[model samples]
Every structure is written in C-alpha cells, then in structure tokens.
Target: MASSLATLIVSSSFFVSFILVLQLSSFPSCRADVGTAASYSAPYLPSACYGREATEFPSSNLFAAAGDGIWDNGAACGRQYLVRCISAAQPRTCIPDQSIQIKIVDYAPTATTLVLSDKAFGSLANTSAALINIEFQQV
Candidate 1:
C-alpha cells in the first residue's frame, strides 16, 4: 500500500507539472523583456521615422516612440513589440490579462522606456495612471 501511494503521488506531481508547462506555453509570450512605458497624447505627426506621413501610425493606433535603449540609430522605426502592463505605482491600475502589439513610430528621448500612444497605453492600464512597468518582446 505504501509503494502504491508513493507511485500515485509521483504520478500526480508529474501530471501537475505537465499541466503547468502547457498553460505557460499557451501564454502570448515566447520570450519577453521588462521595461516601463508612459502615455503620449495626439499630434503624432511628423514622426522621426515616418516624417509626417499617415503610415507612421497603425490603424489600431497602437504604437510607441522608441527611447534610447532601442533607438538603434534610427533602425527601431517600424519595429513591432508586444507590450503588457505588469505593474505600476498603483498596481490596481493595470488591466487584467491585457497586452498589445505596438509599432515603433518615432524616437523619444524623454521616455524611460518607450512612449505609447494613448490608446495603446489605455489597453494595458487605466488612463488615469501616467506610467506602468511593462513586459515587452519584439515580435
């Protein structure tokens, strides 16, 4: 009876671990990096990358202005990133299970990480908050 109990326990442990892995795999990220983001209001024209062109903004208005870290001497333009709000000064500000794919539209020296469009920022967090720590991965 003892041996059977041990065997069952081991099997259950393995099953639980397998389920956990499967659940993690189902998450949106394959690999992600941590950072911070701030919101930016309109007049998104004359972008450093696209130069006042309508193409600078995505149809969904989900876009970001790359900061120093990813500027890559202007190569960051048009790059897309998957960004999610992980935390903030007020953790409750973050929307649950929310993430957005944002395109890089310009360069921003003032942002801690990147400057997200109002719509993009609102998707991951409440508009009332100015900033949020984030998990991001270039896609």
Candidate 2:
C-alpha cells in the first residue's frame, strides 16, 4: 500500500507539471493572437541618444521612442516590438520582408508619433520622407 501511494503521488505531480509547462508555452502564441496591430507615421530621429541622460546607443541598435499613450514612463525601456512598413511616400519604398524588431528606449509624448533610430527608419522606408507609416505590435 505504501509503494502504491508513492507511485500515485509521483504520477499526480508529473501530470501537474506537464500541464503547467504546456500553459506557459502557449503564452506567446496567445499574446500574438490577441495583440492589436497599430499603424503610424513615425518620424526618424537622427541620433539614437534619447531621454534626459542622453544615453548613447550602439550603431546597430534597432530602437524607438514610444508615444505618451503607450509609454509607461521608463518601463518601456528594453521592451521589444515588431515593426512593419505599411506605406511610404514613394512606391515600393519598403523592402520586402523588412519587418524589423525594435526596442523602446525613450518617450515621444502624447502626440501620435514614434521616433525611431535613423537606421531603423532607413531600413523600413525612404529616409528622406518626413514620416513613414508602419504597423507595429509589442512582442
């Protein structure tokens, strides 16, 4: 009887552990399904150094400044997002499959504008344009 009880406990524990892992693994897929895609004509910031401290960013850094509504103060720092160019001033300005991931490193106020690094903007669309439309979702 003692051996059987131990076996049952081990089995129950294993079942529960499997269920927990399955649930955790589904979180990313669930979030992607529920995430709302937003479009914006974000302006490009020539310099990546943003915020009061003017923290310098690496040349290859793909980052953006979140607008006030979505900006959680500095909480947005290091949050990753997937950005896709939806439209541009010129035809075929955006490269195919050019959707790039960017990290939030600063704030852009309540105004409807996202300030991206020059490299990030240039990769998505014609950098000469004052603004470029893009679809983005938080990852």
Using TM-score as the measure, which candidate wins? 1
User: What local lDDT score does residue 23 receive in model 2, on the 0 to 100 scale?
Assistant: 89
- Model 2 lDDT per residue over 20-137, tens place: 9998887854332111122334343432235444444444667777766567656776777888777766777666788888877666664544667777777777666656666777
What are the clashing pairs of model 1? 46-52
What's the alpha carbon RMSD for model 2? 6.6
Per residue, candidate 1 scores C-alpha lDDT tens digits across 1-139 of 9999999999999999999999988885567889889989889988999998985588999999999888998999999999999999985999989989999999999647889999999999999998899999999
- Segments of candidate 1 deviating more than 4 angstroms: 1-30
lDDT of each: 0.91, 0.65
- What TM-score does model 2 achieve against the real structure? 0.56
TM-scores for every candidate against the unseen true structure = 0.77, 0.56
